[model samples]
Target: MKIASFNVNGVNGRLSVLLRWLESARPDVVCLQELKSPDERFPVREIEQAGYGAIWHGQKSWNGVAILARGKAPIETRRGLPGDPDDSHSRYLEAAVRGILVGCLYLPNGNPAPGPKFDYKLRWFGRLEAYAAELMKAEVPAALVGDFNVMPTDLDVYAPQRWRDDALFRPEVRGAYQRLLDHGWTDALRTLHPGERIYTFWKYFRNAFARDAGLRIDHFLLSPAIADRLVAAEVDREARGWEKASDHAPVWIEIADG
Candidate 1:
């Protein structure tokens, strides 16, 4: 099955681009981030018409996430991270589709670091780490897929030195990502294309996309039970160049039936 993840930026605003990609790519499952719309306004009709059944957790004009299963409804498994009850960001969602447990997330950007937002980002990462450990223990065929918002290594960045102090490339942030991977999850894309430059996002300014100045922020981390099934992983880089396109393109993987 082909599973994909895309940070749409805004589901409503990018509806056309998203629909166009969906029709062409035809992934079996998709995880979307940054819906930037409220639940009541999630544009369910348009998505359904495109042949996807979806479940979304939305917030007004900010973070949101959704899971879409082609021609089927994903059985809801979880919503929101478990560690914080007061946290209300719509950044995490999970579901069961075709015997795979998929967890979709939008990790915090935490820009302008050395501040509260950055602190929150670290805390959230810790929570994710703890929860991910539990998932490892469950020994289930699962994948944590989404815009993690952190580049795991210098290889994943266009210019590592330029982004050293940036939250996304900062040592602390990158360490957190490595810790998560240490929990026995396979970083699918990197595992397949070990030495290649693969990037999933680009800045709109400074001619980033045109220059191929990008970052590999979106990811598909597979649990050990299904890691061996991973057959292919790639970034749909062309989608990022489309008119009125999102800064992020889609990242996807294909897994052989176990």
Candidate 2:
């Protein structure tokens, strides 16, 4: 099975780019983040026409998430992250596709540290930790895939010193990410390619991509059972260089059938 994640930045604006990748890569399942469109605005026709069925949770001009399954519809499992009814960001979505439980998430960026947004990010991380622990207990074959918005280690960022004060590389967020791995979730890409300076996101400004200044914020975390099936992992870096492409490239993994 092949599963991938891409943060399209804006599903509507980047429809062409997305469709192009979907046609080229043909992943078995895809978790998309940053739709930046409301539910009613999602372009279902285009997606379906591309030979995929999708379920999305969207909000106006902001965060959104979706799961796309090739040749079939994904069975919806959950919509929003639990433990915060008042939280309205469309950042998390879960579904069952081809026997694997997939969780797609757009974790908060938490910019301008020591502020309200930063606080919210930490709070959201806490909720995720709690829920992820429960998911681990369930012992299902699962993978949590998305743009986590945090660089878990110095190896994940191009210039670690430059990002230390930034919300994405701050120690607090990195520690939270470590706690998830410590709870038995496998960081698929890192596990497979340790010591490699792989990255999935690059800033448009300052010729980041050209300079190879990037960050590995997007991830695929596999449960124990699914981890055992992991065979390959890669980042479609060329997609990030496409015309009007998203800052993030598609990240994917291939697993052997059990």
Candidate 1 wrongly placed segments (more than 4 Å): none
Per-residue C-alpha lDDT of model 2 across residues 143-247, encoded as one tens digit per residue: 999999999999999999998899999999999999999999999999998999999999999999999999999999999978989999999999999999999
Q: Which ten residues in a row have the lowest lDDT in candidate 2?
A: 161-170
Worst 10 residues of 1 by lDDT: 176-185
For each candidate in the order shown, give its overall lDDT on alpha carbons. Answer: 0.96, 0.96
lDDT score for residue 143 of model 1: 96
Poorly placed runs, candidate 2 (over 4 Å): none
